[model samples]
Target: MDNSNGMAKELAGFLIKHYTEQLHSIILSPDPRLHYPLLVDFAELLDDNPTLAHLLFSHPAEYLLVFDEAAIWAQKVIFKDLKQWDNASVKDYVHVRINVSGSPLECPETFPSIGRVRVKHRGILLTLKGTVIRSGAIKMIEGEKIYECRNCKHRFKVYPEVETRNVIPKPTICPSQSSKFCESTRFNLIEDNKICHDYQEIKIQENAQVLGVGAIPRSIPVILKDDLVDTVKAGDDVIVTGVLTAKWSPDVKDVRCDLDPVLVANYVRRMNEVKSGIDIPDDVIMKFKQFWLDFKNAPLKGRNAILRGICPQVFGLFTVKLAVALTLIGGVQHVDASGTKVRGESHLLLVGDPGTGKSQFLKFAAKLSNRSVITTGLGSTSAGLTVTAVKDGGEWMLEAGALVLADGGLCCIDEFDSMRGHDRATIHEAMEQQTISVAKAGLVTTLSTRTSVFGATNPKGQYDPDESLSVNTTLSGPLLSRFDIVLVLLDKKNPEWDAVVSSHILAEGEKENDNCNEDLKSTWPFPMLRRYIHFVKRNFRPVLSKEAENVISRYFQLQRRSATQNAARTTVRMLESLIRLAQAHARLMFRNEVTRLDAITAILCIESSMTTSAIVDSVGNALHSNFAENPDEEYAKQEMLILQKLCIIDEFPDLKSNLQ
Candidate 1:
């Protein structure tokens, strides 16, 4: 084996030992039929560790990480293994005869027919391991062994003989169907001249082993010699397995999952020698592996994918989605897309304590691609995430803020709660509507800011024990509802948890300082993230369905009817949000169909946010209004002042006369 292979083997062995030692202690479960001790090596293989070659060779495809699909396969394998091990003993006789499907079979050359097997154990027959039951196989006949009782001279099948001395062999005292057997002789002859012995069933299990080299894992796509563009069809499952390249679009201005066919083909061809399974070159694998590790270790790829797909020009300033610590604190490792891909809507929020890395993720995302923009909720002009007025070559130029810049990518907003309340009012228009129209500077310029926003904020006072419900916090209901996901972060004291956090932090720290400021020079890992983000945006686009359209329309109509003001604007904004969210969900699912479910889900998310905002605002507004304008309270205060004057008058009557 080459150096890479040697390394893979060593890594795989280490992982196997590590997993086996920790399996019982951990909650890790294994299937009786399939080996789970092999998973550690499987993960190592994906890591492309050369030491995992032995495990890979035996069950290469089985352990290949296919994400969601792999989990399902593992579950099934575990169930099958457990079943086989539950009933392992009872193979005492080399050629034991058993009745199956109305036919007698010994050593079971073929499986008992499906119908027969179902009938044997009340429609749930248990078969031994390696039992092959053909469709036409028959059940065995009963009463093969029988004997005549010597005492009664009556023929009967002896299943469990009682006393051997009192009973005769062969023609007397049948041993085939009796519950008792004779005790006189060790072996008793039944009517059919067959000898019978008492035997009990025992369960047996064997360690799962590979009979031969397993199939190549689906996750590891082999580089085919053929050009995918020339040979692959639209629906064909072609794995290009090529290195990513930089490709930008002015229209999207963000890093989306798009690939330049030319770039892809070029990269694929340059990876190694074509048309050979000899082995992936160490140099080539190492370069890609490093890239993969870097991408995985950082949030660059995930954020870039979102940014590139949404906006590209102002991708700078927005942070990437690399807040692993924040995610853990929120009790979420991975969140399901909010029904957008299938039905069409989703909302996500990022809430955290100070220094929880939320700001970093947003800023990284903004700067990673040309498509994203960054904004904050500090004291600023109201409406539109970022709108500025300036002279434009002899005319007033209406400049758009981070939201507009992130038209197609992502809008990374920091200090979201710190934004002015009036300015917050303006976002209600752009967030849902996808466009920011400025009716100022004597110019009616509407900038298209159809972006996915990843907003970060800290809670007021302290983190609450119950965060799911809305309370008096800096984050308003209107804004919170816009997000399909609500993630929160808090500090931890657990060592194990801290180790995981440290691993991520160390990985990120060691990376090149891509984003450096005077005091804090930290790398955001945007360049690498941009590549992955662009890849996803390019390849993932789901179409909206008519059914989805109907659902959204009805939802909008309802929202409009319920809204106190700007009903049409709110409806339209929510509509756009639903569409974008649906598209994102579809991309995540790797599907092209934007079903009705996706639209409904999108509607639900939008409505939830809108309703919550309306409630909170109404309550606050009612309180302010009632307290601000109360005629009765004012009269009461005047009356109290008059009474105090009268009481003072009596005591100071003479003093008042002198003053007069």
Candidate 2:
């Protein structure tokens, strides 16, 4: 006991010598009664006293108490007058939050993943990263309650045990004396003497992108105390530093008494950034620049190289791959003068036959984004796609659905045609407005759904050249318009194409990739490709050049003159889609200026998406298109004819902006 006291005194001296400034500020705060934990960097401690730091990680419960005592004593020593801030003398000080820097001692290689946390990690400090799937209602829990015995009128304090959380156990006999002498089991608890603190339970699930194929995502319960409670909610990505502890499961008849692991959070930080909290290094950014510099002259060909990495096994769907890249690396989001928000994310829809590889693209797109949610639309409801109110522990809590959870990322829906009409209608607001408004169970709030939708659906029966998309898919015009690029992938009978697909499939690994022979040399692997995507999204935000704007205006006028069957083609939404695609294309080429070539490419994308006869005659099937030898020359000739037509419309300035 004397040795332990000396050790604690040594730790106290260390604290006073190291964190004197931090302790002084916290102690001299306006309200000393409030708990303001002094953040102690563990790395600094490791440098100062390696032995003490190692002991702190091993026996956290005992050492944390000592650290708390040291912090209080250090504050009093530094300030000299601790009672000036508080009316009475302080008995207990706030906790010392140890910031675990660098890699933890979980695996000795890297920080432990959520699924890697096991029995060996219990009672020790570790860090975890996960998404908050659900959170319980905040409630006051008793930390310490005072009890008075009836026999001798003796006072004692009872703390809630881990197994029986929030429920203090009653004493069978008087704690003041032995049961044989007292012969009393009665005890009275004083409500006024109870010490309560805010508490909540949050369920965190591992990242889906990190999980293996067909493996079920694992989740763990986290306990938040005091100031940590209610700091985060569903759909948030959080990093928690805590101690792993175990609690007994519910006691039921014929049920085994098992212990479940739960984390008691020491510190919780929320990362609400759009990048999914990925930290990219400066050297990697230099690599990206060097990757582009290799193909300085032919930028379009260079972009195709990156697109080749998208679903590499699938053959000859250059257009689909290009659209996927543009959708993932979307345009800049800005607010207009009227305070209306313009979304930058691009939505894509693939309407194809059974063998057209639509589902392949959907899966690949989901895997491409760091933060994504993939779900089938079969039997899906508005509550499932948006937000739903769930009752947990007799309290109402708002649970995030597919779109809500995929905020600032992608939400891919397979079998989109299988969803009900009412269910499909619920996502119209989420797709365009980028938010889900919930007013249920006496909770009224809005959750962000700033995600791009990648949906794949089949057309009813056979392809109809004369019918509109709404009649073919049974989707409303408003809903259909939400998608910026609606590519129709009809598996038309062509013997040459069939022979090519047959030879490719049979050859397997020996299949020839004719579309990207030279460009595929610079194709990146999956990890590097994903990092490149995140890099562009985090760094680049492109703005339109005047030439790009003019090209977009010309295409909008041409579409309005064509009198499209699709309602999406006729609205101002189409114009917004054009600008977004152009900006995205510019970013894909690693340029800040949305070039004229970018505008021309976006126009060609829109032209191919439509089913008009004029487009089919001029632009070939998108699935069969390849990287042109000289795209600039081809685009120049095409824009010349469009410019000739624009000259006629130039006569009437009033007719502009009235594309409807």
Candidate 3:
């Protein structure tokens, strides 16, 4: 014990001398951006005292207490040695921190899966990688408190202890006299000498790629203090270095019973911004390159194969599948000099009859995307879909919704027409501007919602052969116009088509049974396709060629000229959609330039949507009618016609009796 005390004092003196010599260089350095709490390498400290270094690596919490005491001792030494030269400024602002690096003694454990972490690992220093799901507000916590006794006018300091029943400890007796303290002898908190530190809490969930299908994601709470607070936001992937600690209930008699584990983070590193390629095997890469070469050599057959690989179980709807494929592989997002952003994501809407495989396709898309969320219109409200501010511990805390949570990925919404009007209106801004503005309950902020929306809905009325699509759907014109592609699937009465569909369904069922007996095989599995999409989005940025530009421009001009009155034929949004689709098509071919063929494919997709929605007739003529304009006109006309026939029958009494 005597040797330990002497070693601590010697280490304190050494640190003071080291800081004093480095102070001038730190302040005079050319680099203006220097991190506060200056980092001290552990290797240098180990050279001075090997025993202290060993203690620090083996038991960090105890070492942290010793280091903090040494820091205070060093401060006093500096103040006394430099009394004549701005001593107050150095005492107030200069902070030194120790970061253990290049030390073989302290080898951090491998990051554990969130679901696999156990209570036995508490108090151990470990590293973990996850995605931030929620973040709490930054707050100030009392590190040390000072109290002055009224009886003796003496001051004492106490370090705030965590997981203790008594938060504020009382001094045993008056310092001047060893007597029992009475009620009149009170202690008042001294504000000027108190030490406070910034603190925050965040919840991180396990990464999606590591979990199997249907597995529930698990999360852990991490407590960040001092310089580490507010370093990351929700949806960011981060690597956290921290010591796991347990929190006990204040009312519990036994401190060790039912302790809830939490982590106290020392450092956080954002991982998403760093470019780490997906872990694809070398053989897989070679096969992927050969597949692309085939696509480049034969464009038509390659495109068909790609579409088939997207969702093999669902038969037919080839155009709809192509649209979904393009949506998965998004285009390049661009921002102008003025900071205005143009979204590259393409939105799709599918409206069809029952048993049309709408929900199945949506599920398949959600599974293939790297980051995605699925919700039903009836199950989610406006606040639940966007952003909600809830009161937590007497302060407003912002919680991200599905759109905000899937910012850089996909959002799949089913039964879209069943949602309330108010609820549906909330997504209008998010759909176009790619942002959600919240001004509820004194908290006002705008959050990014850069997500591609893929929705499916059923028609309102029964399937009618002669009626237009606008009459059967419940969506408004403004909402319909936001989708880049809208495909309407009708059940046609064709025996030949029915026979083919039946045969395909039966073949799929047999194949599934056969796969149970043999090893399962898929041409393009979900994992490989997901990695391919991520690679394309990360590495490829396609530019439009002159020929492609001419083709798109001519198509837009032709559509605008042919539009009739009150017809929802084309707008500037259509031109932007065409460009996005063409770029996505170029990415599908693994090319850096949008070719004329890509432009033609984009035009064909747009034309197909327009035809299915009845925006234009068979011969390329505009249909000047919609659900939003004079919605009740058809009902009123039918009622008037029935009343006129009733009047005619009333005038002819003999005819009325004959009918009866």
TM-score of 3: 0.72
* C-alpha lDDT (0 to 100) for residue 19 of candidate 1: 42
lDDT of 3 at 15: 77
Q: What tens-digit string does per-residue lDDT give for candidate 3 at 1-660?
A: 355456557767767666665544333343433233545556777887787776765666666555655655665665555555541323233334555445443442435777777866565545677888778888877777777888767776776544452155665554443365433457777888756677787888887666888998788878887767888877677777666776654344454455556777766777755623566677876876788786664565555656656666775566777788888887788986989898999898888787777898898888777678888999889876898877643667677777887787889999988889998889988988899998977877788898999999988867553544455676766677778877776565457767866776777657557742242353366677767766667668999998688767876776676644213437788888899999998887777999866876787677666643212332121111111123134323432332233233354355346456
What ranges in model 1 sit over 4 Å off?
Answer: 1-348, 390-397, 467-472, 503-529, 543-585, 593-660
**Cα lDDT tens digits for candidate 1, 547-579:** 566655655565566665323226344555666
Tens digit of per-residue lDDT, candidate 2, span 295-397? 7977766787788789876777778888999999998999999998999999998888888899888888888897788888884678878988887545788
After superposing candidate 3 on the true structure, give the runs of residues whose Cα lies further than 4 Å from its correct spot.
1-60, 64-119, 126-130, 146-157, 162-193, 205-220, 246-261, 274-277, 280-287, 336-338, 463-471, 509-522, 562-569, 611-660
Model 2 pairs whose backbones collide: none
Local distance difference test values of all predictions, in order: 0.38, 0.78, 0.68
Please give the distance, in angstroms, between residue 641's alpha carbon in candidate 3 and its true position after superposition: 44
Superposed on all Cα atoms, model 3 deviates from the true structure by an RMSD in Å of 13.8
| Leading candidate by lDDT | 2
How would the candidate models be sorted by TM-score, starting from the highest? 2, 3, 1
In angstroms, the error of model 2 at 499 is: 3.0
Q: What value of lDDT does candidate 2 attain over all alpha carbons?
A: 0.78
TM-score of each: 0.33, 0.86, 0.72
